[model samples]
Target: MPLLRLLCATLLLAAAAHACRDGGTSGEPPPAGGGGGGGGDGGGDGGGGGGAPTTPGWIERARENFEGGALPASAFAPDPVPDDGPFSDGGAYFTSRGVTPPAAFRATQPFGKDGWLTVESYSRRGDARLADHAEVVADPAGGANHVLRLRSQQHTDGTVVRPTAPLPSRYRVSLRAGFPAFGDGEAGGNNGYDAGDETAGPWWPEERAASQNGFYWLTILDALPRPHNNTWIHHHRKVVIDSDNHHPAWMETWTGDEFVWSGEHPIMMIALDGSRPGDVKTGNAFFSWSNGAWQPSGAIRAVDAYLPDRWYRVTIERDGPRYTLEVSGTFRYGGEGTYRAEIDAAQRCVWHYPVDAAEAAGAAGCVDEGAFVEGHPRWPAGGAWPDWFMFGDPHVNYYEGEVYYDDVVLEVWRD
Candidate 1:
């Protein structure tokens, strides 16, 4: 069953690359590089089954564990505390869509009441009809059994975050997240996922960001206002398409912009930012567990169970220009562990990017090549801080489903 699951996922991965679309930006995956990326060669059972990573001396700056049943005052837009933003008079959002918001929606604040955080989308593209929602609700995965759920059948690309004052260049962010699970029987969600075919090799994850039904694409968590673009973690580093010296050697026709994990796999990809011209913000690592290894064959590795409904915690910490991405958690097909057994984060990887200069400069180098600082002229120096961590189709290419987030936190590294 595990082998079959992995096979089905790989088949879809290649197609996902070409099929994935992009919005709010016109860009393709980084051009093939002079060398293949490193780290894809190493991977193991990942520390025993379960729990989140640990960080010492990191002071928490902002946190949201939606146990209160509503986004706290810290989640809404800043200031004078009025009945707006997430707490609008009601229907404005739906009225724009030509539908009347339920009367009950008018009675209680559905979006949010007050908070230090707010919701924003990287792409302004919004659908009027399908669905659009953001609020706190019950969950079987959250540490507190509650979380902030955001969705947009309209596929309005967005993410939730806490507004803040700029701080030192170094900090860390962590949170628990997962897609909503339905169909208790086929319940875990990955009932019939197919990236297309097995042996197709690792395909670009982010497809064309145009109109999409919204499958969980990629998760971006990193410090913003800095040179490191967290979402860029989805970077394909080098598309390999339209080139001869590509690294993977298997995916030669691929031309997608990001690495799209099919499902049931704790996978990630990275490329050095400046490996080639126009490859700024690219990543330099890939972590798809498979065949008992991370990036076993350079693609994804499925767990013993299903994926869709499983929850996982992701944490990204940045110090200067360097970043570390850590993931933890176990998942069953659904919260009930009915369809299959619990899939521990056994295929997980604790990866750090931008290998040292000498190594990165090597043939299969993994290094960051962007140039920017704490307050570079490119990004405004001071003002309300931008979203530090966001989920739910941030690319604005295409996604029409909802995802949950809980115990979202931002912290500063204590020197």
Candidate 2:
């Protein structure tokens, strides 16, 4: 049964140049690098600077596990919150006060715990009209425990931020915050912020300004497969937004200007507008999760959870390739052994097949099998297929939202 289960589950991996097996020929001169050309290696060659390919280690591991019928049942490795001083997990966390920025913007202060350092927009693409600011600070909560805080607001035109440095691959990111919701429908709602810049290009609407849009709290996983943008991994959580309504908050993950996550590196974006344990759903808080993948993968479950207006800690650790989500110290969703067995027994589900750029470009990569997400409260209605949200444009995504992000940590398993 386990073998059958494993066999039934399809493996979704982004094609990388290294992943593309050489036609099994020795001394083959690699093809010339150019813009929009025919097949070179396999997938990763997505028309970038020299079209750099990715290492094929993780993909190989996934295939080996799947082909063997079931992934090795290793015990869930305990990810202990380190006892080192000053939010120091010793080797667990890398604190960077100096987060690099792109060419258009420079850091007012390198990232640090001393004071609130921020990045302001001076000009974008020779346009001096852009006005936006991002502030980051680290606060010492208790003995050796610190929280990193970030607030980004783009109030005017031509404001944007691309991380100074690329985040390590295969890391989980979660945030805690209160959001002021807006807009009635997905596109019209005043979520919090608006995105208007040249990068958004033709998709940038000069007339219709999107309100209730900006993210008060947003989580992003960086450096995923190209073409399809960030490699998004879905996770399950029993969360109640400020609305106290039963709708699940979206944990959207993306890379750069793209609102897609079909490649790798899934990020988490949750909505905690008005949710408290055993409390009445009062406020109207919400968020959305979307991706470019053909299918999405992850877990979403409920628990007693936490309350708003207070500091709550959410942690997720992947045991091997599987994920485990925890709130405070208890397991709410996605864990192993007792946790995994319980969640699976309670809810049987599947994810959408992540769309592949290589596959789209006619490579022998995995294509979309179907969108069969069970157990999720927001599962699209029966017989209705899940598709991408109409975010105006395809290439440029004006992600404008308001949220406070602190104690940001990322762990990548490259074994």
What's the C-alpha lDDT at position 55 in model 1? 37
Cα TM-score of candidate 2: 0.31
Over 1-415, each residue of candidate 2 has an lDDT whose tens digit, in order, gives: 9987665553322233335574433356556663444422111223234556544332211100011121112121122322322112121111222212222322222222221112223222333321223333333233433333223333322222222333232334333332212222233234334432213222223323332123222222212111110001111122211111111233322332344322111223232211111111111122222232211223222222222234444444333222344344222122211111111100212121112232123311212232222222222222122111110000112333333334333334443
Candidate 1: tens digits of C-alpha lDDT, residues 91-175: 1322343433221110112232234455443323322211235666778554547776766443223343433443345666667
The alpha-carbon deviation from the true structure for residue 51 of candidate 2, after best TM-score superposition, in angstroms, is 44
C-alpha positional error of residue 350 in candidate 2 after TM-score superposition, expressed in Å? 9.3
Candidate 1's displacement at residue 157, Å, is 4.4
Per-residue error (Å), model 1, residue 362: 17
The superposed Cα distance between candidate 2 and the true structure at residue 367, in angstroms, equals 3.9
Q: Model 2, residue 138: what's the lDDT?
A: 33
- Model 1 scores worst on lDDT over the 10 consecutive residues at 238-247
Per-model TM-score, in order, reads: 0.43, 0.31
